[model samples]
Target: GGLPYVLTAHEGSAAFAADVMGRLTGAPGLCIATLGPGATNLTTGVGNAYLDRSPLLALTCNLPTAQLGRRIQMAIDHHALFRPLTKATLALREGAVASVLAEALQVALSEPLGPVHLDLPEDVALAPATEAVPAPPSGRRLAAAPEPARRRAAELLGAARRPVAVLGSSAMRLRNPGLLQAVIERHRLPFATTTMAKGMISEEHPLSLGCIERARRQVQRELLGGADLVVGLGYDVVEVEYEAWLGKVPLLSIDVDPVDADASVTIAHEVVGDLDASLGWLAQLPPARPEWGADLAARHRERFQRALRPPRAGFVPHHAIDVVRAALPRDGILAFDVGAHTHQIASQWTAHAPRTFLITNGWSSMGFGLPAAIAAKLACPERPVVAIVGDGCFQMTVGEVAVARRLGLSLPIVVLDDGWLSLIQVKQVRRRFGLYGTDLGEQALVDPPAHYFGVPAIGAGSAAELARALTDALVADHPTVIEARVDPGHYLDTVYD
Candidate 1:
């Protein structure tokens, strides 16, 4: 494989990087860790992969077989630790290393791909006479939806007065993702996207209804409620469950994974199989004259845009995000950490293609943004990549900035310094609770450092300064940290409620 083994500052960071690799490359990403603490640190990222459906191969060392299960120093049960967090957990025996790894790869890469753990005993790592691992598995054509279900789904769509296709992240994993656009546009149906699915089709497309799950959510929900039919294109409930949006409306789910049978949502038809091929089947559907047309989508898109604007702002985090979005290209990759800022980025940022807009939603974790951006840069070095993280989240993986500097990556890590765990503080304010520990010692009032480790650091106190910094950082020869001072108080009005 031509994959690069980039060392991250922490095992947790490495795990995030591995998940990003798997999401981008569609192969099982590999991550190795020492025993005990290292493997434990990997759990959060691996769990993120498991729930978010990214393929990963997590490898960890354990005590030698002779002393296995004994109370050994620095040795904890690797399998038990990873068992709940991964798709499968295995211990690689001496002679079966290749076979075990081959199996692990398959399990990790299986449909609804997820993380798998493999343990290599101390003795096994030093063994000889081992055969080389074989070439990786090639892609296979997943089965298309059964004729009956596809026809049934098509019939439902044909009869509906209001039909909406919701593109989810899983759809991007399919072959010929263009088929998703083809099917929806062929029928002149209006569509909205889940956060992860935003850029599968250009958001600029006239039929686009913007994203659900963030910013002016009521409008998106209203649009969804008006639909007599809801078609899930490669949608996964883990992103946003059906009961939350679908209501009692008839659903036509077409994806690689089957719809959950126990879900409370009504299934007019559930078509499971190759989502790409199913789109071809859907192309044959008798087109419906949608009562809800471009007018509705335009209205919703505008409202989304209006709500997306940072409100009553004297340099809020939302304004900083707007500057970054304006400066970044339509095709640029943005990896963001979880916090109050994520609420704004999920809907405001323009994602031109899948995987171009990367964020952890299902297992939304802090410290993910920097590592994910690092992995994206490694995967597509020619592309412009940036990470926008909040002050609190950035502190979790600040050391990883040094790793980017060492790689000499021309990356920009934009940190929004808001002083508090603004997302949480907002919640406390609603209950009239005192904002005691939420403050990070008045970060915005403090002077910004000139560098993080060896990486060049700059300060941006205004929109113009932030834009200039981004323009400079994007083309720089090394990683740059642009810390922008801002008040995240606007989130108290927007996503806080």
Candidate 2:
């Protein structure tokens, strides 16, 4: 109970920290705040995690029951507001802490995980219940599944001539990379991941197919749609584009939660349970043909190699990603917030393991990368955490740079400074919007940004300077901010709508 507590400068960072911890550990992440303004400020982060289906716990203090709904601005409907984004929401009643906590934990950890809010009044939190809090059943234990469904999944995985497996965020949390690897090797199947599911298996693995978000359009065209059968293992198509296209492929969906099911479902068979166990059973059936595996594997490697063009010389988007990737340890973690830059980096930066890459795929929220890196470092202090943030987004949460320094985390942040909001600027160029609110002048640039959080931040105009800044951060004991100035034109591939 005596855990060390950190004072975060902002509630959003706290919520993000909880979300990352939850995603990384496969356990519920936790966040707590005082009454009134604290609760309201934390809502944005709560909503972000909820929309992304991240398992999180947000705890907030409320006024006494006597004050319920009485001219209280902060007394907004917490339960109702969260219902759309969460599996369960609760306002702690008198003497209900233990029972409520147990139930909340259960709901929070269950399949189709999402942010769970708990409103505890000050009086209720202090008031002790006479009875012991009932211990919840081990959250990881699987519920029984019908035999027919299991057989169907097995049959689908077994009969296919050219089959592939798509892993999602939930599969990564379940931490069965070995099991996944076993199935892939036994059946000789190519494995692909959604953006959030990066690093679930080692990228170095021959069968590792790479991320769908980054896969070349050609690969998406030829390989993904070409499969005779596709297994969506904890895959949530809602987060990925090309769902309508995926509908055409024969889908065998395996999700533990009913909410994971889609109304426009193309699944011929659905198997929900402890995925590791279900998959383990499926692996026991006759192994998939080696020839089928060899064909897909060769095509996957060929496409990945084709997608990669040596980062263009000079100041290019791919070059920037290459610089960062070169400086990073082969297994170092990376997080990218939504921006025009993300499309390029996601396609370029190679992830080697699960939870190594973090992003808000479903919410596509701006100003999330810095906070995600902060959160990732907090959870795994041993790893090198990098945030590839945009010029526009860097301004939004740049204050957190000071927070990182204060936390004494040696986080290295690379800011891609292009004067305009590149993504929006592209949209404006495409004439999607008559008015371009995306334009910003020198005023938008953090003038004298050289010194970030009192640490001497360096500005890089070319690849050489970029390399020097990265070297300093890798060697320094303190946090370093490397501001790389990139031409907006260099990112035209992404900026052009």
Candidate 3:
């Protein structure tokens, strides 16, 4: 009863809040809604958590028990509807409410965390509870690495002259990132992160190669070619397909779950247990060569720096991101929506800490950045939060700005207004299919006296103007939307190429 709740403009998009909260807090995020249409609306967010492996508790108030079996108004089967999107779905019974809720929490918090569903029937919810609520379950324990697997992994790593570590979303769950960093540092291993795990390790570190996003695939491919062994730490196939890892070099996987063998990626050795414990074991082994990929990392960094300094002729997305990076505090949080802009941002934006850069890479869902930014702000109110979204994504969740304004959050929504579904348009053009549904004809919303659902709307046409607009928006006491008129032509060279 003492818990706090935040309301959103759309119930379906509320899962984005849970997604960000769960990720940032490493705890089960709570999202509540009424039954039928309300529950249906929550499915996108729930499914997002499911695929992204963000722990969430989805609570939906259902019709009374008497009306459950009948074909009455708003009485859809919540269990059946949520079954596919959750780790488990249970309807709250009168006497076992506390136990059911506890069990749901456990399932959601277990390894490879995901969303769980509980349909609280109105009658059951109103009924008196005689049973006492059980104590919360003990913290999850990490299984120690097996001796034989540890030996195999150590031998493989020791024999390799060039080893590179690939960090993925699961790495974010590590209880101690320092232990993993020690392993990388002690071995001088050149490392890169998956798109979803871009900030798992600080990108500013000397060993950081960069994120494995589409924009940096060329550099990553070159580095992977020279790698004698690929050490995957907390790697998940959902972020980057196994096919991308298939090659002559064998992989050494360390994760809570077994490798996805069907991906055709070779796993020479594996240590399945807590990632921290696995890394702890690896850290104790004799350090590998100190200069395995130092030259490669330097080359990668050189190329990356050049990419970050894009032409400033007009409002370039990369330059805009660079400006945003300089403006926001080093620890401030940034959320990105799926689009051409995301490729550059995810690749070039150097995250100082985990959870600083949030994106739905696994789900690659649109309309996630704005809502996720709101959730990030609520979770860490001290740090500034901003959403970098595409014009198409902004339209999908523009209504959420009202929710942000109502909460009096000083969040800024920076929309890259290119007047089209730029990513799709690029793909269509590359595939020799003329533009069909990608264009969004000119519709001026940033004219004088412009307001986006009561939130101030500012326009920025150049890097300098975008910086000024962002500065004003960040200092404002309320949410503001900066519509930056950007050119999508860069996608032809950076992404579609």
Candidate 4:
């Protein structure tokens, strides 16, 4: 196998590493660990993959069969521990390795993809087996939309005075942008995406309404309520809760699997088949009312423009986002860590293509930015990759930078230093409880001592300096860490009313 193996400092962070690898490569990612603490450490990443719907295979080394269930050191029920977090959990048997691995891989790559766990006891690993390796699993065959279902979906869309498309994470799997674009253009439909599907369609497109998580509630209400039919293109309940559209609109789900909406959300029609095929069918139907969502699109554009403008002073996250957006090439990929900065960046960052802006909104896990950047760089070595992370998140997995340096990766990591868990601090202020245990003191990650991890470090306290630093980092031959001092109160101005 030509697969490269890179070790991380912590097992918990391995989740982000595998998540980014799966997300970028569209293959089942592998994460390895030993029993006890290593196995427990993998739980965070495993659970994150489970919720985020990334295909991951968690391999752990367990105790021997004889030692199982005994009060031995580093012994625990690995199967029971991972059962809830994985699609399937198995203890590897000496003679069944081939079939077990094949089955586990299949489950991991299936629709609504998730993590699978395999516990390999030391004795089982050393046991002699005569069984031959099984053949690789066959390629997955996508289900096509049935004629009757297609007709019903077409009829519903045709009858509606106003139709809108709500794209979700599952749409990313379609990989048929042209067909989806045709459907949207043919119907003159205004489209919105979940946070995870930020770049499903280019936000720069005229009909795009950006991300739902970034939109104001009133805007979401008006757009969704005004629609006579809401066409869900590969929507997943895990990405965006059904409560958002419940009783607000009539949904027509079009996905590989049937709609997973709960009782509150009523799906009028469902086309349970391939996304591209369904969209191709819809594209062949008569276009909806030409001016159905024109007004809403205009308002969305207005808000999008307003959101991109630089603040009067200070290092505003949106301003930083705009600077980075301009600095990187159109196809460059950006990974964001979970924090107050994510919401603003999700709204303001204009992704020109799919898979450009990566974030962990599904798991909302911190310290994902750096690992995601590493995967992005590996996936597209020719394209630029940057990680925009918060101070708290950077501290969580900052040591990974050493790995990046050793691998000779020229990754630009921008650390937003606010001296606090800014997202939680904002929530605390809103609740009038005051910030406690959130502060990390007034620490700035400026100039590193010479040869610090063999990486250059830069510090910026203003928008201009930050932009300049990013420009330099982008062209640098080695890894660069940019510590940007930003206002902690900026979240209040951008996120809240």
Task: TM-score each candidate.
Answer: 0.96, 0.89, 0.96, 0.93
- Tell me how many clashing residue pairs each candidate has: 0, 3, 1, 0
The worst-scoring run of ten residues by lDDT in candidate 2 lies at 488-497
Which model scores highest in lDDT?
1
> Least accurate stretch of 10 residues (summed lDDT) in model 1?
136-145
Tens-place lDDT digits, model 1, residues 192-306: 8898887899888888888887755676787788888888888887887888767887888888887874567888888889777888877766677788755777778888778
Q: Report the CA-based lDDT of candidate 2 relative to the real structure.
A: 0.73
CA-RMSD of model 4: 2.4
In candidate 2, which residue pairs get closer than 3 Å at backbone N, Cα or C atoms, i.e. clash? 199-353, 199-354, 200-354
Rank order (by lDDT, best first): 1, 3, 4, 2
Candidate 2 stretches with Cα past 4 Å from truth are 125-137, 257-266, 290-299, 305-313, 428-435, 442-448, 488-497
Candidate 3 C-alpha lDDT tens digits along 178-212: 77688888888899888888777788788888877
lDDT of each: 0.85, 0.73, 0.83, 0.80
lDDT of candidate 3? 0.83
Evaluate model 4: give its TM-score. 0.93
Off by over 4 Å in 1: 1-3, 139-142, 261-264, 431-436
The sequence of per-residue lDDT tens digits that candidate 2 reaches over residues 272-367 is 777777777766878865345455665776666556543445576666778998888867889777887876666556787667888877777787
Q: Which ten residues in a row have the lowest lDDT in candidate 3?
A: 441-450
Candidate 1 lDDT for residue 183: 89
Stronger candidate by lDDT (1 vs 2):
1
